[model samples]
Target chain A: MPTMTDEQVRAHLTHEEDLSLLHEVSMKTAGVSRLEMCIQCGSCGGSCPSGMDMDHTPRMVFAMLRAGMRDEVLQSNTPWVCVSCYHCVVRCPQNVHITDVMYTLKAMAIREKKYRDVAAPEFAETFVEMVEKYGRSYEFGLATRHYLKHAPLRMVGMAAMGLGMLRKGRMSMKPRTIKGMDQLTAILNKAKEMELT
Target chain B: MSAYTFYPGCAMESNAKAYYTSLMAVAKPLGINLEEIEDWNCCGATEYVGMNLIPAYSLIARNLALAAKMGNKTVLSPCSACYLNLAKADHYMTERPALGEKVNEALAAGGLHYQPGSLDIRHLLDVLINDIGLDNLKAKVVRPLKGLRVAPYMGCMVPRPDYNNRWSDAEHPVELVEVLQAIGAEVVDFPGAATCCGGHMTQIGPETAFELIRRLISSAERSQADIMVTVCPMCQVNVDAYQGETNRHFGTNYQMPIVFFTQLVGLALGFPPDKLGFGTEITSTEKALARIGVDIPKPTEDTPHKQAGLPMPSCLRKNAKGKVQHAEKEAA
Candidate 1:
């Protein structure tokens, strides 16, 4: 029940050679990720709805990071399969920021171009491209591009439903451009530049 | 009328148009004024944040800056992803000042600045339950949804993370139940209410999403829910649109209609069903509407039937008087 100061909580350095992966992941995560505090309880895995589909559970991923298994950790489909439901996040007794860690792992994998499963990352890239271009997501365009590239045959199956969505006035044919696209572009460009530093 | 700046996100204009229509219909009667942020962009959903931390935060922060500029103390989002992103950006910025400074530097490029906590970010459900109040809603129910049994599905994003300590419990929040009960709909004991709806995985990993969707629809079927009511557009889209595909994957013909909570609320408020965007869902609500009569028939049995188990955990049950029994008292 005792509360610690922010300085006290963040003062400890976790820089052992084997712990380098853990340290980088924690640092890259937006806030204090508490990745080092993991007890390897498997609460995250137990609570994850898609844990069955993950090659390694979140706890295993954390353990792998501590062991500096960079290639295995990034190559695993665990991060890509993560739906960001945050079930593992709240369930983690150590408060390891499971979902945020997944995001960081995903970004790292994308940067290194080391992922085994390409569809999820490609989807993310396609989505980002849409956002960067129009300041908003065009689901119609996104679906078309993604389905055609990744699941061409499935796209044929999806045609009926897509047409249904269109007929019911749910899907828009054209993308919406925000009035302040120039402003959004400036901020995004600056952020991208700063991300490099 | 309480006025709050609204961030409709991209889904409202397209896939979740019914949510938008139904929400607007109920807002006037509920004494809420939703002033949408001008020229607002997407919150980047879950895609941008995973790609680059800085740009994701910057993109989301842009919406916050714009909302703050509008002079509203509270900013509301209807989409769960947008709600989470907005709240997460503001929360992390406050929790880590360095990140805030970097994001603010990005904001400076757009001639905007966000002071992180200046505007309170809230989901539409939070406003409905907390600001609008269940009692007020109950009084306005011109046509109680008497026979309609709905599975109140909150999805995953809205309840978890507990950023502002807003939700009652991370795993099983009863706010949805309280609202649904107020409108006179029979809320089923839906265990999958707070579970994942597979999100954008339908596009990237169809098999994974199909299984997740199967679990939700099958759970609803087990409980005999007439329809599943969701707060998130993504949840509705995944469950309703891909339901046929999910059935084909599993070789099971389960026909569970997924609807926005606002659509049901609009019906209770006596708006014409068609006016509230009723017929737009992929799985039709025609059968569900036929069940609701003109009036709520009083329960013939005086006491509400208790779940046939070890006293149906207090969060999952309401007492005979239609009040939630506190867990401690129930245990005693």
Candidate 2:
């Protein structure tokens, strides 16, 4: 992908005219009252360790959210790259739950099926699938499946580390499921059913 | 013995086996009896909350409900993600009654109920530093890490959103240093100690994650630390596993052994290297552990470094004849 020109940037389709997106985000994130309290101080941007990777900083994202740019917000790589480090949440003078908001954005992306950042969503999907299956994260299974599904070439490189850990007894070949899995599944199912309606 | 329900989380049994092993070694010495929570599931990590708030919190709350049913008031977790999720669920459920009702409705199918604030979710580091006094920890030290300069990497989760007012300081908690100093290691003032490791970003965006990883490693190296000691399994795995990739990205050769704090404490407590499982790291603890006179096996000679990140295959410029005209350039 080549860098976009000034004309391309101007021509970029933005849902800035969509007011419903702001109301929706505000309702979901009403808990973080600081969503409206952000002063646009660049502390979050400056303090972010992975800010360079994100298309928009925390401050920018908040501004974009308020501006009702639904497509722009969804297309930004900021939320997917958020590792939940909480640097922005803690440092915000307004006490905004920036990390949690990032989670909200990530969830919105997945729900809307709009993934700007390609790999993170796959990792999240692989993680959720693994947990939904055995009630625990099986590293060998997760790594094998994640690499195979996403990047098969990298699996060759990962073999040495994966096999080394396996030989060292750090990782296991067998999957581990917790007791009372039926009850756990019932609880999860109930939650899913409630979310639908 | 102070009793608490132990939530080892999902990683303990697999990728972070060393943490599990070392924590087990210290349990007896610390006189803190940890009963394992039966049938504990995943905490939904950082993903589930974004997809659907109710289910994610409920999944984490289910573990709390299980612990409460066991009649335990406190729950201890070694994994940072587990600790944060458990604590966050308990906190949020109390703050939002509607959320609490919805989550409880989900739990009702399992014939269970969780009362917010019923369980005290604490990180293992907090337990070791607070419940098991540093004096006792120091007294139990058989092999002190006297000359080893350690960077206490608490990651980011343990400190923030203290919701319960447990951590002394959100930004700069001295818990790791206090505990490490008791073990006789010189703990450095690491600025990136509290900074994010970009969590699962290495998988999402390698370049993005690599830069974040380099910040901590290079910061520790600049501080002249021998090794980095961490409290969270994710932090340990991220710093340890992707360290080679971080080095490759920056064209720097930094062989920092990112280890679990418990492994170091286990060594200081006179636990055998094999018993503590110190050699399971990808960064190779040989150089780091050697500073404390505890020798571990090397990471094997065939693999010069641990396999991590995306392998950069070399691309060549083609001439008219298609013969290799120039040295192979690293593919971007």
True contacts kept of each: 0.69, 0.57
Which runs in model 1 stand beyond 4 Å of their true positions? A1-17, B293-332
Model 1 chain A — which ten-residue stretch has the worst lDDT?
Answer: A8-17
Error of 2 at B224 (Å): 2.1
Candidate 2, residue B53: how far the Cα is off, in Å: 1.5
**Model 2 misplaced stretches (Cα beyond 4 Å):** A1-20, A29-33, B297-332
Quote each prediction's TM-score. Answer: 0.89, 0.88
- The lowest-lDDT stretch of 10 consecutive residues in candidate 1 chain B is B295-304
Residue B44 lDDT (model 1): 92
Per-model interface RMSD values are 12.1, 5.9
**B111-141 in candidate 2: lDDT tens per residue?**
9899988889999999988898999899999
Docking class of 2: acceptable
